[model samples]
Target: MAAVGIAVVLGLAALLPTAALPCGALQPDNTTASKLLGTWLYVAGAAQFPQHLLELLLIANGHLQVEPGAGEQELPVPQRVAVGDQCLTNNSTYFEIAVGNTTLVKHAKTHQTVGTLMNLSSEDVLLIQYQLQRERTYLGLYLYARNLNVSTERREELERYAKCLGLSEEIVYAPWKTELCQVRDIEKGNSPCREPAAVVTASPPPGTHRPGSAGN
Candidate 1:
């Protein structure tokens, strides 16, 4: 009986992390694809995996590209891919996703489902969440916005979402430095691949929690 009890405890321990995670808000059915087009900044984010700055541009009926800067090593070359024809949805804002090229896979080995939740939880924020192992695994969550700098209330709101999703540990602040961010607005017909300027400022050093990372 003691041996069985120990085994049960171990099983529950492994499951606890996932069980405690929050489902986040649901995507309303009325939401449409046009609502997602814009130039979004990487102000704050949380995940079970490493977090960093990633600027995203959602082009209407075109491509969704990203530029990562700040916090860690320079981001992988900007990823640009055509949005899938259909975004898979389950009617809940929490699990809904903006589908991406379904042909791409991680390490070219495992099939992955990439999706984004637009205006989820708040209109000022967008979430990109991933699922693997046939949608049974929730990998990570990214929070992006139009403003380069995050307000205190908005930062707290991101923290709350991270906590709810059980990603507090992986949370890292990607300080908003104009030089290190994609300051262009594509919605205004700006170029998506403009080279970032090399301007320096007195912003907080990287790895330090800014108001955006929910603060240290």
Candidate 2:
């Protein structure tokens, strides 16, 4: 009778809801770092703040290239985005791996934004959450993929995750028809569209929210 009682208690404990952990807590590892070494396309994003949401809405399409930085502590990320009729490129930003999967992105040694990397159900999709001013209350969630677009299931998953994060249900999806700026063109400064002078700004202009905009 005592053993049966213990078993029932254990089963009840297992059935009880556990406290939800902050996103990316204890999830980053060497495998995740390796997976982030290549390029990823921005799929959709949501934010708790309106400024961040506006930033996401302005982006037609965006591409991010992640490269291993000095040692294992840093990852250099270059990004190019098509906003309106102009292409904006920023190559001076890098993320420093702060304990575990937490990252601190710095631009021109000025702005600093804290973020975390979380892997979703699909291997091709990655979710990044940027905390506002180091607080979780106001944050933005951006989803990236190895491919140009993700499936409806993946988008639904993002919506669920956003809800869990207390972000707005309205997600801004980058249009698929917009031509993404080529990395080579961006590097060569030869894109046909109006190319802006590379600036040290970590986040985009007000309107859509972007990753690494925590400090902004």
TM-score of every candidate relative to the true structure:
0.43, 0.67
Over the stretch 1-216, how does candidate 1's per-residue lDDT look in tens digits? 000100011111111232333464333433333344344455444544322211111111111223322411111112211112211111011122223311111111111123334235456655554332222333445556655455677777666666666654544554433222234433333433322222110011111111111111
Off by over 4 Å in 2: 1-21, 98-111, 134-138, 183-216
Candidate 2 local lDDT, 151-172, one digit each (tens): 9999998898788878888999
lDDT for each candidate structure: 0.31, 0.57
Write down the worst ten-residue block by lDDT for model 1.
Answer: 1-10
Model 2: worst 10 consecutive residues (lDDT sum) = 1-10
How many clashing residue pairs appear in each of the predictions shown?
A: 7, 8
Q: What count of clashes does model 2 give?
A: 8
Model number with the top TM-score: 2
Best candidate per lDDT, number? 2
lDDT of 1 at 100: 38
